[model samples]
Target chain A: MNNETEIRKWLEDVMDPEIPVLSLVDLGVVGDIELKEGSVFVEIRPTFVGCPATTQMKYDIESLLHAKGFDDVHVDISYKSPWNSDMITDKGREALRKFGFAPPPKGNLIDDIDVLEHVECPQCGGTNTELQNPFGPTLCRSIHYCHDCKEAFQQFKPMN
Target chain B: MNKTALKELLFKIADDQLILGHRNSEWTGLGPILEEDIAFSSMAQDKIGHSYAMYQILEELGEGDPDQVAFFRKAEEFHNSQLVELPIGEYSFSLIRHFLYDHSDFLRFDMLRNSSYELLAQVSSKIRSELKYHTMHARTWVKKLGTATDDSISRLQNDLDALMPYALGLFEKSPYEEEIISENIFGGEEELRSRWLELIAPIISKTELVLPDPEGVEPVMGGRIGKHTEYLQPLIDEMTEVMRIDPDAEW
Candidate 1:
């Protein structure tokens, strides 16, 4: 496997501490990973300026690489370009589904869709949900109450 | 406030943030746990960023570039209150500091959001949005640690006791006190302090932590006039090392 492919696989197992089903890569927080001269440089942006998961994400990345014999790993935190929901990949959406959290609803009329469009439930596949609060498990998510399931789950907000 | 007084007031607000942010950042790699480490580090970064934004406004008013204002100022020339300059004694202590300052800052920025100065008002609005998350992040840890095991609760209490005096320093009235408030440049510092106390009282009560009596504690001074603790020098040195290597280089 190419180095990028190998690192991607290792990163897939690095789950977010708050959201067990979602890995850092899946959340699209891991913006870019470059390996140069046997050293790994990983660029990441937190869900917000003060998201608590940033430190753990760095440590987990370092440890994961170290365990895989890539001893020299560096994690660079950047806030130049803010994080947005569009960054989350297709595979990440699938992972979220498998983990029992609903993936964001499919785009319909992409041009005029509001950023706060309703998120479908991964469990019962219900659209009868409302945001309970903007702040959720982490800074990037919002608390949504599924009217159908009557369950409160954290959903990633589309950062503008 | 006269222009000089306004400049001094801005400096105090800017310098305090710059130094406190630097101290909190030391926890980046060293926090006890992964989740907390990230959280603390991010808070530190936000503080610095807020400082930078404020300093930029100062620069526009011809104070100097943000870097020089942040890095090159003499220790005595810094206006940050004593609270932000103190060491981050322990994780629990740091959390207490965060708890107090985040609430205070939220109120401060909220007041600034309505400043008569349009530029300052816009900047305040942006900073206020970011402060909300900082408050939440700090509140989460404070609640968790305050109600956790016996050891955790005790540590937090002790830290709160030790830091309360310094916390009052954050509201020290600068030379421009009257003019700023009278002109509605920003709200009065005394009022801000009272509101901060009110906001934090419930949180402190919920966490089972003692709310330090604001009346009895004499507010520490001089950070508003650029006087700082011994810890600030090395912090400034390290933070500015890269910028100083080539002052004119684009970061």
Candidate 2:
């Protein structure tokens, strides 16, 4: 008896395996939900086409929906509209900062090299930070050091 | 489209991505700076994942599974360009190789985005966007290092000279280039190389580094037909060391 809205609420519980602090909903990968006849069709997009977590994410979505009694669940991957870091929700930003990652910038940069140049420390709210590397443990992150806090932090780079 | 030709094209691209991704990953903790470490590692993940997806496409075309095709393949069966398989040397060497490789790769994906093959077109479109950032990253560094100081300029120039021959090997043609072009799967590697030249020349012009005369250097070929440098087999062994230990155990 649960509708698309109800299913969406359930989806918010599906955390990204990589970024454990944020749910797929908050990450903005959960695209559209349609309840057609007895089948529920869910569309999701991966943040990166080569993201290894994508298959796991689709499986998690299916399992969560099936556990909630949606028997005929179909998950489709969408690539028509690209995923950008700006798609990350405000709640996701808070979760990222709480989880020790500097959230992606809200505004899209014309020049992406500027990404590491202006990162503020999530730990001490300090502007005195230097980019340690544009590469990180993960594809979407960069590393930086805060001079004031003396803490090294990972930043979610702004995806184009 | 000829299925064989399409598969041939896809394999080369996938193999290149896989090998380079592994090589780029070797920089994870060894970069001169932490930022560069993270940068190279990020690109490594992207490249490796790209290979995984391409392998999946091959699976759909009736090839083996992605894991088998990637991790289990012998070095001689790999179709990657020789340029990508060379070890990541000094920072200048790596950077120069990165600059040359990414320019051609970005352009290649851009061309494939409009491919007649629907799945390939879709994949290429997504990949092309990601590669845009990669090329931008390469260009920024090449410009910065190419013009920075006498020492920096000379180092980059030396690496650039050393790498150009192998870099030209990126365009080593497929036997089915005619079929590929006829079917519109790709615009052919020769076209991509010409375009890459036009694209890279301007970037080099801004820097102090001199562009090598294409006529002066003979291109290193045969990676497409499986003649790789001696370095590839060892690299592959190292990459698959863990997987080969227990082939069937699930993580």
Candidate 3:
């Protein structure tokens, strides 16, 4: 029953349904984990309120914990605070770039002169890239094209 | 007292988001610029996600599964406004529609944040934050393109004029509008329309685009009661293409 570190280790493998390269831990969506009286309670904050993946993520977490023999598991969907792209760990950013999607800039888009002007191409590492679209295939992504590689890629959008 | 009325209200709002999200998604890979392609896709996903959230609320009140409710419904069964169902035509038309629809869309969410229905209120509070980005994106484009070059301004203005009637369809009142209002599930449509006008007018004024005379234009109605244009069914068919192929398949 004293498998707290093992539980955390198990949770680390739970990937974000949308961006599969990043885990819930890497995305910073997993908040507090508490165990009491043989019951485990975990809090997860969604990337967006309407994210469909949030529902699946909850189910995945619960099932994973259940498979681990933690029968009394409670997954609380927390809306007390919103998730920001900035919460994405440096490792998560590298994973995103490695997946061929440009990771969102570290800080807010408001700090930049132009939101599109500065993104480095994930494919060719080119700063001389053009913004193809400020919006992309998903709510958290935008499309960019690199002049060097001439490849069209998606960038995880910078969230405010 | 009338649960049906509340369901109708929810259905229309959900349907509008779903249909428009589909339309916005069509811009993926086809946008004039790649950034816009992604932008439309992002908003499309957000809108569809919002619709799915609303559908889940409906399921709590005894509707079918969200996937079936969204993907299996016929065009005639849909309650989305005509504005949303229309093809995402030129970039100007889509942009103008986004500008027009999202402004009212946020206002509706703002009103629903205080809904007497606990679920709707909870959903609204969560959704409103996401929608702020939508409105910001819409407004920024409307302002940027609306004032840019002579060609851009003229194109945007033409779109504004053309889409006015359809845009007004957004406020077509529910048959249970009074019931919903009486129960505090929503503020009335007239109230939302007025607030929408007040909010959008100044922003539109800032652009070279002129606001169409609201008094003279006739709002296209019927979407609130499930009547849609010829376009909706085909769009629905396209959206459900994969679902129809294998309803049991994991999307």
Best by lDDT: 2
Q: For model 1, how does the per-residue alpha-carbon lDDT over A38-153 read when each residue is reduced to its tens digit?
A: 88988886665446567889999899889888879999765445455566789878887777665554443222223334577767878787655444444555557789988867
Which residue pairs in model 2 clash with each other? A132-B34, A132-B35, A133-B34, A133-B35, A134-B35, A134-B39, A135-B38, A135-B39, A136-B38
Q: Which scores better on DockQ, 1 or 3? A: 3
**Residue B35 Cα positional deviation in candidate 3, in Å, after optimal superposition:** 0.6
| CAPRI quality level assigned to candidate 1 from its DockQ score | incorrect
DockQ of each: 0.07, 0.51, 0.34
lDDT of all predictions, in order shown? 0.75, 0.88, 0.84
Q: Per-residue alpha-carbon lDDT of model 2 for A1-160, expressed as tens digits?
A: 8788988899999999999989999998998899999799999878887787898999999999888887899998876566777889999999999999999887767256666675888999897898776656766777788999999998987775
* Best by the DockQ measure: 2
Model 2 reproduces a share of the real contacts of: 0.63
After superposition, which runs of candidate 1 have C-alpha atoms over 4 Å from their true positions? A1-160, B249-251
**DockQ result, candidate 1:** 0.07
lDDT of 3 by residue, B90-142 (tens): 99999999999998998999899888887788767667757766787788899
How much does candidate 3 score in TM-score? 0.79
Q: Rank the candidates by lDDT, best first.
A: 2, 3, 1
For model 2, residues B171-206, the per-residue Cα lDDT tens digits are 999999999999999999989999999999998999
Worst 10-residue lDDT window, candidate 1 chain A? A107-116
